[model samples]
Target: MLTKYPTPKKLAHANLSKLTEILWNSSNGRFGEWKAQELKNLAHDSFGVENCEDIYSMALLTMLDEIQSLAEKADELEKKISSLLKNFDSTITSVPGIGPILDACILSEIGDVTRFRSADKLAAYIGVDPSVNQSGEYTSDHTRLPLPAKSRLDGLCCCCAA
Candidate 1:
């Protein structure tokens, strides 16, 4: 509809019957011949004004368009990322609790697992290992794991735990 009437002002002033006809025709009868009253109500609610100059409807429409564009871009990027992740052989995703996203996050944070000497080191790297305190032969039991300084690693660990 914006293609026919680029501005809210133009759309608000446009003939209701003409607009309804255009909608019905353009939608291939899917809209089922929208009544003029229905169209008027829709215009009144959406446009927020009878006069174009008094309303911020154009700005709202522009923002909505921008949001829709960004959403499309995000969906495209997510598809590309998922495709790329599929190329790597990952057993992490096979674990009952983990899915592709968490598996990808874990793999990305712990690149080349051979670099870590042991599972304990890996746990520490991901900040899952508990913190300990000892003083003068009296040792405090490790009770809590400190938050990971690396935010991405923290997210990975949280995903795995969940």
Candidate 2:
């Protein structure tokens, strides 16, 4: 991008049509267009942040370290789940567009696949089955409202989307 606009200020004020073409590509577009317009506005208004270096305080850095540690823990758990999934011979992952993590999650929720007589039964158990919204006066098309019995709501989206 620097080949076209060499400086931050020059790129900052680049015309909207050209900027969108360049940015793949706000205010009206808000994140005010990915904070670029906000930057431009700040520059135009001569706005400045005081004591920006204070952002690097020990408290923020400690939280960042904790976040990194948690991320690593999550990755470890994901790998463990993927490994555990291999013991089950079910072809749940054979469904296109679904991945091992989702397959593992849905399978873990449904413990024994053989318990369900058919695919429809499995889908219903996973909270993906749509139910009629009807009263004496009105009825709406089938909508998926998560069953109170089912604690994991993510299954609704994963099953339907898959």
Candidate 3:
């Protein structure tokens, strides 16, 4: 789709039916008439960009290609990581909402939990353990809490959230 109409002006002024057919065909019929109209409207709205057709466009195009290549490599790396993670009996992977890639990355970072003396040490290492406030013989238990926001709507308001 971009190859056919790389410039905003060309896309904005393109014949409606032709653009729709190209978009439809390019997307294998997934993007139809509505998407074409949307793109056309978007192109019309974003005009007077000289760089779109200049030497900057070539650089932009090259960067886009590089991004696509990097994305493919990342996906491949993720699959390899997931496969590698299966060899270890990780409790992290057993937890709800935790996936293989994340577990693999975390396990790689915090290798061999036995190295930490205790669970508290692990928690402190990960920066989750809270610090206690103490001074000489006086130990403070009070923790500062966030102030409640002012009520935008009083009891007279119709909505519950408001």
Candidate with maximal lDDT:
1
Q: Candidate 2 — which residues are off by over 4 angstroms?
A: 1-56, 127-162
**TM accuracy, model 3:** 0.58
Measured against the true structure, the TM-scores of the candidates, in listed sequence, are 0.54, 0.50, 0.58
Top-scoring candidate (TM-score) = 3
- Please report how far candidate 3 places residue 73 from its true position, in Å: 0.6
| Candidate 3 Cα misplacement greater than 4 A, ranges | 1-4, 15-58, 94-98, 135-138, 142-162
| Least accurate 10 contiguous residues by lDDT in model 2 | 25-34
Candidate 2 at residue 65, lDDT?
73
Task: Evaluate model 1: give its lDDT.
Answer: 0.71
For residues 1-162, what per-residue lDDT tens digits would candidate 2 score against the true structure? Answer: 344444344555677566545545213343424455654555456533435524434445667679879999999988898788788886867877666777776666678878889987766776666677889989887675557346663543555385
lDDT of 3 by residue, 119-160 (tens): 987656654456666789987896432221222212111122
Tell me the number of clashing residue pairs for each predicted model: 0, 5, 0
What order do candidates take by TM-score, descending? Answer: 3, 1, 2
